[model samples]
Target: MRARLRAPRGLVPSLPAFAWLCAFFLVPAGMVAVFSLGESAYFGTSPVDLSAPSLDRYGEAASETFRIVFVNTLQIAVVGTVLCVLLAVPMAYLITTRLTGFWKYAAIAAVVIPYWMPFLLRTYSWRILLGDHGPLAEGLGVTGGFGIVDTLSGAQLGVVYNYLPLAVLPIAVALDRLDPALRQAGRDLGASSWRVFWQVTLPAARPGIVGAALLVFIPLMGDYVTPAVLGGVQASVVGSLVSSSFLESQDWALGAAAAVLLILLVLAVLAAAALALALGRLVLRAVRPLDLAARLRPRTGTARPARVSGDAWGLLLRGYGVLMVLFLWAPILTILVYSFNDGRTLPVWGGASTRWYAAIPDNAVLMQSIGVSLRVAALSTLVAIVVGTLAGTALARAGRPIRWSLLGLLLVVFVTPEIVTSIGLLLMYVAAGPALSDGTLRLVIAHAVISTAIVAFVVQARLSSLDPRLSDAAADLGATPAGAFRRVILPLAAPAVLAAAVLASTASLDDVVASSMLGNVGTTTLPVYIYSTLRNGMRGDAAAASVLMMLGTALAVVVLAWVMQRRGQGKSFAAGLVGR
Candidate 1:
């Protein structure tokens, strides 16, 4: 049967995506890993490093600041993961297993829509909505009291709000796949709902939760916006530390070391999570007893389901969900509203005018930054989508060796922190010895490595549902292997490939950490420029910048969503796009 099975076509369905990943992921990651071991000079600005094997930077990471930031990064990651999981699980449960009918799809769509928005917009919106004197405080009538506008709480909110959907969707999918009958069986055997949940639900959902935690934790550890805006100086996470080191303080060695430590920390956490889960499962299996066909079956009685009456608790959940949604959106709203401001209070609607927006075309650096960012994002996205798609398709069609090599390459980027990734890219660029000194090319290469990893996973998921039969049927009708692929596979997978391309583009567009470190002076991205504008006190120009970036991202999301909806197979893929 296996031998008789016709071969599938060009893998073109995933070709663009696969090619994007390949160009971006494997090549860039390889470049970065090489650089991490190399040396960086003049704060990350000079050039790359082409040196012999060494651990000097890794050893230098032993400083107190590195230790503090490392610990803090881990703390943020752990706490953020826990918080997102707690909130996401309940929300996902209620939305998925619990609720049905009209609100179900709408609820999922609500979460979906915001995720598609630009992430920087999402971060900035929180700052606006959560500001101490803003409507969030006033609405709750906090009463001349405080708010989390600039506190760690605000940072936490930023992390959770941006990532909640990321955490929720994966777990919801896992929980949705659970056998409902498992719960019923436990109930029929006299187990309480809570007991059944603890035994049946949590266990099955564990992998998904672990996946969610890994997804959230890894990114949180490397994130810069949440900390920069919400955290301010009150407990700067590792990402902020790395950015400061390279961009502000010129502490390249320390930054490199810290980046290296972060990579190690990520590995340790992954191992620990895996090991802990394994042990937990083992312990649960050993101790957990079967219902054992309880001695006397209870008289059958219709089970009264736990009801959510949509009262205060329901209202609270709905309100929190809405607030979270607004938190994700309101900054863009504020930015939009304030782009018209004459340069006054941000959260409030000061006088309106288009002066700021009009004046933007005159601000050369800002415009230059915009140009540089778009160029970088565009190239990076192209590279990522192509490389990512390539890896995905190859993995599907490849032999074991090819698959392993491809995955191993993706993992390098997946595990490497942005700080480390940047430092590595710079050092390696220098090490390449002036041949690849063009900053734009370096940025593209750097982005490809990291983004290709994500593209691969997404493309792979899309490929799972693909019907090989389509390709096989084409091939049997005299179509060549390549022709079959071009005719059948490419068209079917076009939606996923396109979606991945947009995703990679947007992520490249918003990134600051790596861009700050590796982007040459003239090539700073939008986030870098906005950070610069913030020093002038988040003014109208800055607001305008925020608005511009927000609109750009929002436009991308809309296009992507439209593309996804047209495909009709985009529900899952759309949900996965909450954050980069």
Candidate 2:
């Protein structure tokens, strides 16, 4: 009787969103998959001609030039992911162990605030910093072949700096969730501090570490802006290669083939991870007998006093924490300082001035793009809030089949590289011709497609943590289902929903790859505008726009942090985005 009463609710509220995704997101993605098999067709042709498809495009993508790009993508992504993980693990440990109260939040803020700046601006700042006369090269006396700019090393550095939050937040979540009792148990068993960490804490944190690696690696493979501006023509990665094929070479078939290949590569990585997890489970099962026997046996060693070296190790970790914070923010701080430079060239201090800030309103193209981005972000966030909140609420009470299906859809959206999705959507839009090719509409749809999954994740986390009994109690009273949702669930989940909206708005504004591929003459977002400005040597103007965008982003993030803190979730919302 009790089990029957406890059955899940909210399934009915979810169907509208499920249908919306099927039409916009799923159908568009299916079109991409179908397009992958065919030759590039002339515009206004039938959408999918199943009559004759060929493998020639795939063969073309495997050519010698592309082979090198593929290798570089793998090398750079792996190295970048490794570097981010190694750097983040220690800093996460420091935050979880050493810091407390207000200082704890401050340390996390230091790490996350750099992300408030658009990614393109952040990567371009690296371009300024690595120039011949810049602080880094001049201070270190680097020159000739030893220079970082225009090299793969520079691209790798940019990737690590940009993606570090992906690693830190997840690992911080894992460490935050550690069972204190288990740590005490290890010490009570006479294990040293190092042994306790190795056996208890590190093992518990492995999931977050693996998640962090996947999050960093998947996007880094398709990174365009970093390699484009920082690595220049010399350093070719998969994203640059694919961009050239479509935008520069106009070989749609070859670009689609390459994108399809990249998607497969990401899928293969996920498959390997799944296989490894299964093998781990098997090994754990095989070792359970020995573990049980050992536990049953008595221990003879006396518990020693807690190790005195913990403070020393903590101090060392705290130093690394400070260094990591600086590494993440140095380029951004440089950009902020350079925005005020009166000189035409970057990194040269010509008396302090707000001339660039004053010039922003005069750049009509830049101002137009800002207007487009604001509208897109506003529309995207509104759509995401409605659809994602419904889906999130539905998933909370959904039975196993529905839950797994929605979860799989979310994973598909999450792990698919942005470039692959961008190209796919581009192909889909082109096939539909003039009637459906409205750039503003396409940009909004693309932003919503990407933003919905993230918003759903944030809302889902909050919904899962809600007390079902309150809604039930309201139902027992005079409240209708709609009324109960409004009075109980809605009020409880409002902060997370607000936070999700803020995040969605920021993501839409900051997007570059999709904006680059899908934006037409009428629709260029801030990131796309900044990319072009940098390419054309408009440093001061680009800096002006970036400063304005960062100010807006900073406002959004402050709201996000405040709401998340009010919910007592801390930075868990940031972790959830990647962990999902």
Candidate 3:
């Protein structure tokens, strides 16, 4: 008889996450694809009618209106991503190189705090700051203020501010991990600081830079909140268009088609970028020898290169860092100050009072929404942690083929626009009929789909740095695989697990896209509530609720930072947040 073949040790452990993604992610996405080829139902309970499938939906998606919005969305994403890279590189450099100990952690906290705060709250804060009669306009002494409130420029600014930290964290982690000796060696070779940075540091940090760009660009492409809140209808993008198609127009076929188009657009942009990069590399390679020859040519005079003063460079970077921190904190601080407004409207401040803050407990809907958000975030975080930890550990021990395959799937989850995910989940839940009728459950499941990928990346980053032999040693000591994981690997991964849990919870709390799509009347999350209120002219009480949410988010960031620090894995922990 042939010997029985056994599965790989890591394969079984990772099956839960794999299965979860297939059920919740792939199936829903497939359903969306199928729905895109169908027509809208005018009479049936279902939004989409699959009886007759055609590519007509795609044709409609390619109409003049969609083409304009698609172009605008791509422009915003490209420009915002470039700006994020420009700002994040120096900010990250300052945090990793200039700051030390307390200040270093303080700087990180500055970025993470605003990042962890509710996404709607942050964008809404900008509505107050850049509004007519706002502080900035008043300070500038403009007649009718800046008039940026309902413009593309306002949306662009908000997108950059909201996603800047996503860019910063990954770059900081990359710079922090760089070997100091490389810089020292460059100095020993008489290379100027500028030359050393350009030649060595920048190249070494390329992966982080690329990661940061994608981190900002992917989400920016699908962001509807910023454009909706700041730009209003005037600055509509593909994301808002898709959303309106589904929620307002009840045109499921058009929405599904738009979502598919958005994904395709993103992939096309990435491909174009890759091709451009490849062509640039070829051009650079062809010219490199000539450039090298020019450099190696004998000098006729004894003149040396003019060196920039290190003090000047340091002072400039420090100033830039200060400005960047102010940029990150400005909107949040604006929210806190406006939360004390005694007036009814959020933007207009009548007087400083704690009335809004005090009235939070009295708002029945707000209180209930907070409760729903907490419950959903808590339950989703729990599910993500369990599934993610297993998948993460498995990836650390799995074969290269298995690891790459899983990683690729997670990357898809990361890069696929959130609006696409939201629409897919919405379609999937609708298709499930009454079986998944519970709105809160739908919210939890959708949030968990995104969070699971985040946690897995964090845990995998932690485990990758550990000794694989530890598990082997446990096995050699007569321990079962389960016992070894419980006794050994679990303890070692506890910090990352906890850090990831906090991060995932904050993500779920801050989510606007998925929550808005998946949530209903009785199951609304706090972010969704705030979003609705903002749409109908935000009130003082809403600002108060935002302040409270920010405080909670800050506490969570503190805990996450402390946990990562305790294990001396602060750098990787930060990078893992963006799945680097």
The candidate scoring highest on lDDT is 3
Full-model lDDT, candidate 3: 0.85
TM-score per candidate = 0.82, 0.90, 0.94
Could you give the candidate ranking by lDDT, starting with the highest?
A: 3, 2, 1
* Residue pairs in collision within model 3: none
Candidate 2 per-residue lDDT over residues 43-95, each given as its tens digit: 54553344688787788888886898888787888889989999888888888
How far out, in Å, is residue 385 in model 2? 1.3
lDDT of 3 by residue, 1-580 (tens): 9998878768877889889998999998998899999999968777888889999999999998578898889888999999999989998888888889888878887887778787887788887787776778778886676778788898898899999999998888888889988777777766678767876688678878888888899999999889889888777899988888889999989999999999999999899988987897788777765452243433466565888798888899989988998998898889888889887687887889999988999999999989999999999999999999998988898887778878888888988998999889998888788898899999999999998888998899889989999999999999988899999999888877877888899988888898888888799888888888776677778778877877977776667666777878676565455444
Q: Model 3 reaches what TM-score against the true structure?
A: 0.94
In candidate 1, what are the lDDT values of residues 139-236, reduced to their tens digit? Answer: 88765436565667777778887787778777877887788887788767876556566667877788778778877888888886776777776657
Question: Which candidate order results from sorting by TM-score in descending order?
Answer: 3, 2, 1
- Which RMSD does model 3 reach against the true structure? 2.5
Per-residue lDDT, model 3, residue 6, is: 76
The candidate, 2 or 3, that scores higher on TM-score is 3
